[model samples]
Target: MPIYDYRCLECKKRFDVFMTYAEYGNKTVVCKHCNSTKVTRKIGRIRIAKSEESRLENFSDPSSLEGLEDDPVALGKMMRKMSGELGEEMPEEFDEVVNRLEAGQSPDDIEKDMPELGDDLSTGGMGGMGGGLDEDF
Candidate 1:
């Protein structure tokens, strides 16, 4: 199926019509706004789709981090792209971190304000029991 864009010469209104291969040439196109038959078909731009593997590979490339260290907003957007490529549901804290980064906050400042978001705290170092899970359970 292909979508065709048309602009009515009478009302000067533009609209889109989705048509199949069989009906593409046989049917008459009409303007949706004014029901005008004097419409001109337009050439629309084509779209391309990329594979998930290609998107993930782009995310993993080191070049993706270029200039990110100095730009907090770019770093946040990069983190979003990374999460999208991984196809996993990021935690709520991850969104907060990204939001703060986009708001021009440094990672060190964010860590100081929210210590639970620290690297060591992400593991079993902070809230977990004194002993390993295996020893308790």
Candidate 2:
């Protein structure tokens, strides 16, 4: 079910109703105030609003990265913004990587020592491994 917004022409009452997508545009919306059936469909703000998932998807699209390699600052800022929004603290390894890159250190000099952080369950690492087979059987 999708939420549809409608405005009453007679009373100018705006309201949301949950209905199927097919029925949304065709359904007659009535005003709650004066019981007027003359209602108009309002353009929803969400129609153009990109969700967090959609934004992430857009960023990850390879086709969108045409000339991003030439701008290192932009890349760093984007990474930092993504990290902040994702509630992920930059690992010490990442700090080292950034520092090394800034200090003219080669990619080979930057050792990968990313320590696993945070609750494993919350991070969705290892889960659903076992069952109470002894008790059930």
Candidate 3:
């Protein structure tokens, strides 16, 4: 599948169309916004996918971390970028934390409001208690 950009002569609007090879030239391309058949296909810029290593390398740049600590929104943006750079999907709580930070809430405040946000389930909070699996035995 290839996406093509078209400029409508009647409405002067630009839109993208995704079509297969078989559909190309078989049907007339029309402007989606104005439904105008007087449209011309234009060359669109190609997108390049960056590798995980390259993305992580960009995240480690000193400029990327600048003002991140002082500004909660900046910190949240940085965290979002880091989450995108990672190969694996981030946990749901991760997004909630970022959203709270971006909304001008401090990490301490967020943690206090959402106690389970960073709960150390492995340590069992009070002590190094197991997952109560021993009771099943």
Per-candidate TM-score against the hidden true structure = 0.48, 0.32, 0.48
**Which ten residues in a row are the worst by lDDT in model 3?**
125-134
Superposition TM-score, candidate 3 onto the true structure: 0.48
What is the lDDT ranking, best to worst? Answer: 1, 3, 2
Task: For candidate 1, write residues 60-116 as lDDT tens digits.
Answer: 777877888788889988887776665555554677788899899987788898887
Q: Between which residue pairs do clashes occur in model 1?
A: none
Estimate, for each residue in 89-126, the C-alpha lDDT of model 3 and write its tens digit. 44446667889988989877986887764364323421
Clashes of each: 0, 0, 0
Off by over 4 Å in 3: 1-49, 121-137
Those runs of model 1 whose alpha carbons end farther than 4 Å from true positions after fitting are 1-52, 119-137
What root-mean-square deviation over C-alphas does model 3 reach? 13.2
